[model samples]
Target: MNLSLDYAIEMDQKDPLKSYRDLFHIPKDKFGNDLIYFCGNSLGLQPKTTKSYIEQELKDWAELGVEGHIEAKNPWLPYHEFLTESMAKVVGAKPIEVVTMNTLTANLHFMMVSFYQPNKKRYKIVIESDAFPSDKYAVESQLRHHGYDDKEGLILWKPRKGEELLRYEDLEQIMQDQGNEIALIMIGGVNYYTGQYFDLKRITELGHKHGCKVGFDCAHGGGNVPLNLHNSGADFAIWCSYKYLNSGPGSLSGCFVHERYAYDKNLNRFTGWWSHNKETRFNMRHDFDVLPGAEGWQLSNPPILSLAAIRASLDIFNEAGMDALRDKSIKLTGYFEYLMNGLGDDVVRIITPSNPKERGCQLSIQVKNANKELHDKLTDSGVITDWREPDVIRCAPVPLYNTFQDVYLMVERLKGLL
Candidate 1:
């Protein structure tokens, strides 16, 4: 709760994960000083190891040609598998339930193909009113593809009048009223705008109680929050690596399918040679033998370069461990909140939840009468933040790289502008 610069420096000196900041290549300003990066919720800072990781793949390609598929230091044939266990540990799922493959939206569509089995009476999908634009569009396209009118088939779980956060009670009422008509519940694990982390287990149980399949878009929650996807009992989940996972921009995404579906070969899914059994995959004349579990959802062989970058980042996550990162994240974000609150509510309002368990590292701050110009000022002051439409400026003090000093300095700059 202390606002002094000495307090911030002391916290940084004592932080167990403080050394992690050195592992990333922090972006620099025009004068060559490191910028205060608080945009991890949009795109994470690249790890220093990412360059060498990609270079190794380039070396293999140059030296071995096609033989690199099986001859490289890390074989390209099973490259995605190298990421499974580490990714599962990050999201609190089993190895069989997780796979790294296509981009986030693509994986979401593929998941919907199998899980969104709409019948005559139950043919609707429920989503948050303020979901990320891509998620809303994907669900709408799914409804259209299934021969339903998008407007009629889409149900929005909206916050009450003038409210910024969603209420579980409102969701329960929606289920009580229209659950039977709802075929699936697809929600953001952590809301992008509000930064409200939903109760995954509670949502899954409620959806199940009403005979609906539940899934989550974990783009904002993946590495930033401890999802525990398996125990939540959600049928499926998808997330991008470019955000909190810290892979390069537009890198591969992670997908999760519950273990209960591991052996369900009968489930309908779009597949390709990559999803076939490895033994018979090269036997081009054989019938398709779909691999079990999340791997079965793969549509093609992944780009090895992207996998290499993901592996590099996952190695760091494996070393630091999500539990320790979460502990630091709670303290760091709490410090940021404490400092922001001292700025007075007249000038700033935080839309994100106050409870540490109900949000990740990101805090969505709405500045009174502010516009894009305010965001530009912060950027000029060497603070990298994201500005949403209207008035919110989102800042994430990532535990992997951001420090208490970074948080303290950001507030100081904001006060100057105000």
Candidate 2:
């Protein structure tokens, strides 16, 4: 790949997805120049239509009051259903297997309540050693809740010495040794720090071979890659909408329960009013006739404004399609990786997988002889990327709105910083 600015501009000119960049509001510097944004892994840029999406709901609420539940355009009662089909498409699942609901950690706990059934003979849980702190905390609490010692009951799958990415063989060895004693296997679909995308189907099959339930926290994988959750055959999975989904901060999370459990009335779960049957939902006090599939996990009615923001973003995804997005992302990040390689192995080291299939659009860069001040300087220079703990700069070039020129400029800025 050419490192010249003209080459980058030429690549952008010939791009099929160049028009998508104008769909979002890109941030600008004090001088009014657009900033090279690389932090979509932390929080995605707002889509141009998000404002109108929320304003429509506000307009309906102001004019129709309680009548907005039924009379308003898009109707508030089944607002989440509006997002189901598109969201399912992003994560590669059937509509009946997916639903938009609570926050990431909350949904993780709710899923554990149903899937983490432990017994004296098999009561341990396995997760990556470097999982997001919230997932670690949630699993620890689940262990204690079931009267097991947190540290004793929780098993970690660690990388070998001098390695950053996890090997599938190491995990297989863990299952080989402790499969009979483990009741659950929960893993991050993508490692947030290293941008390593795990093989969900392989992990699920290995867990199932040992009679263990499997699940994934797809907070980093959602919209960033083709998860194919249904094909993975995981018992359940959850992901947030704020990051790659670009649904605004703290938007509702998506939950996926495999079709095999869709109509399992005997399954143990924590249910609420929102999970009841739509036919008898407003008929006052009655027995809880739970809705089928992932909808049966909802605890309360959702906030429509957030759902509106999600709907706006998902509409864009529906138009662009995940297959198209994945194709562009492979090229975008491949270019980023190529440029970073030109910086010399001594100057900066890339920890993310070189194999495009093993990662998404993110590349975790580690600069030699650098500290947090270096990152601050990059921000001052109008480039935005995040610094993870220990040593690594996490930058995701989102395919939906990011361009070839943006990736080129970001690398040029990093070269200057070095």
Candidate 3:
């Protein structure tokens, strides 16, 4: 809880994941000093190794041309495959259950194509009141596409009037009240605005009990926490690599379809050449043999350059290990919480949960009588943080790169701004 610079540096010095901070190219001010970056919840800093990983692909494409599909160091035809194992490992799912394909929203719609099978009797979809806007839009469109009134078909699981965090009991009550009518439950694994990490297994089991299929968008949770998606029993899930996964901006996304659905070819999905069986994918004469598992949802071959970037970042995750990273994250974010609380409730209030287990590295700070102008000031003062609507400032002290000293310095600047 000490706010002294020495205490923060001491904690950073003791951090097992400390060296990871050096792997990223921290943004710098004009004086060449690194900006205290707390924006990983939106976009992760680039890994130093990303350029080389991409260059290798460029080299192969240049030297081998069309032949690079089979002759290159990492073949383009199966470049996406190289990322499967590590990406699955990061999200805690089996290799068979995961695939790196389309971007986040696209993959979400593809998953809904199969999972959001709504009928007249059971057509309602459940989501958090403040689920990421894209998810809300996607589900609403799915409802309308299925010939249901979007507002009538949508059920929002909301927090109490005076609260920001959602309670499992409230969700359970929703299931109880609308269980039979609800066909699907889609939620953000970690709420973007609040940084609340809902218990995925609890939600999935509740949905299953109520005869509803469950899915999650783990864009904020993917590398920030151990999702254990397999154990969660969610029918499907999707996450982007640009944020906590550090794959670069607008990078490809990862999708997870539970093993039970792997061979269920009867499950309807959109298909393209890439989703055809690998053995006959290039045959061009064979019928559209939709591949099993999450791969079946893909519509095209992925951009190799994007996959290359993902491979570069996944390589780092493989080395650091998710468990160890999460371990540091808990401690790191705890330190952040402690320091922010030290800022005094009169000046700042944290909308994100105080319980470490309920959130990731991000803390949504609500400043009393302040606005986005405060965020701009922080940015001008050489600290990078995200400003949400109303009065919240989102700052994520990502464990893989952010340090204790960075947290201390950022908060010290915020105190001055206030």
Candidate 4:
């Protein structure tokens, strides 16, 4: 496979999904050549069609003002409805169970209000040891707010000694040990830093067996991996649209409450005006009747411009189909792994799991004898990858826009720098 650029060129020529690269506007350096973008985990390259979607919403707002709520071709009152069907297919959820609403952290808080019930006896929350900071904070704060001590209420399911990736057995042990005290098991569906995809179904089953509520933070896994949330039996899940979903920064995020709770009025949620029943919403009566399905979780009218960007991205996903997208992703990322592994262990060690099923598009490489200096050098060379402090460098080969040539170019550049 070290057969030079011809191998990469040949792969690109044979890539059936090569046409998708044209759908996104790849970033360029000052010299006017395309920059090798491998940071899709941070932010996805913009879809070329995004402007048109935004323009439609802009025109409606300019012409109709408040009347646009009901006058626009796709009325603002029902704007979010346009997304449900497509979003459901992407995440393997029923339409009634999914809703695109607030930002990721906010949605996490809201989901916790409803699901993370901590009583006097069983009040612990279980999460991965190296969870995203925002997730850690959210769960910790939730614990404190309920008058529970964070140190005691939070149970971390950590990796084995000297191991980077967490195993399902470790989580099972934590649940078995703290089953009576644990109220919830909130995990990152695919670990952000390690790119380790946990077995969702297995975790959910174990949590349920212990009578603990289970949920997933799918921010990294959302569009990058197949999340059969419904079949996985997770009580809830949340994800941001800006990464693999390709929406703009701080775009609207998605929430999935299992169909079992879609109409369960007993589920205690923090409600607002938008959650009120539509028929009585305009009536503004004293009675607070809630809407059926996931729409009930929505607390306010969403920013249509942001949702417009998401719609544009989802259109691309719908055309490509997630299964087809995953197929391309596996091959493209596999090529990246093969090339990186060929670089030898003296300089590089892959922290992400070796099994394709255990990861999405990213590979976290631990650079030996390298600090931020090596990371800085890679950035200076125009290879756009992210660095998490201490040791690892993350590179994500997004199948939608990245080409095989980009991956080859990156490996070649890294080799030269070393």
Best model number under lDDT? 1
* Model 3 weakest 10-residue run by lDDT: 290-299
Model 2: how far residue 72 lies from native, Å? 0.6
When superposed on Cα atoms, how far off is each prediction in RMSD?
0.6, 0.7, 0.9, 1.0
Ranking by TM-score: 1, 2, 3, 4
Question: Candidate 4: misplaced stretches above 4 Å?
Answer: 1-3
Clashes of each: 0, 0, 0, 0
C-alpha lDDT of candidate 2 relative to the true structure: 0.94
Shift of residue 288 alpha carbon in model 4, Å: 1.4
Off by over 4 Å in 2: none
Error of 2 at 106 (Å): 0.1
Model 1: lowest-lDDT 10 consecutive positions: 274-283
Per residue, candidate 2 scores C-alpha lDDT tens digits across 354-408 of: 9999999999998877788889999988889999877788999999999989999
Candidate 1 backbone clash number? 0
Off by over 4 Å in 1: none
In order, candidate lDDTs are 0.96, 0.94, 0.92, 0.91
Ranking the candidates on lDDT from highest down gives 1, 2, 3, 4
- lDDT per residue as tens, model 3, 1-418: 6879999889888888888888999999999999998999999999999999999999999999999999999998888889999999999999989999989999999999989888878999999999999999999999999999999999999999999999899999998888999999999999999999989999999999999999999999999988999999999999999999999989999999999988888888888998899999877899988888777777898999999888888999999999899898888888888989998999999999888889888899999999889999999999999999989999999999998998889988989988
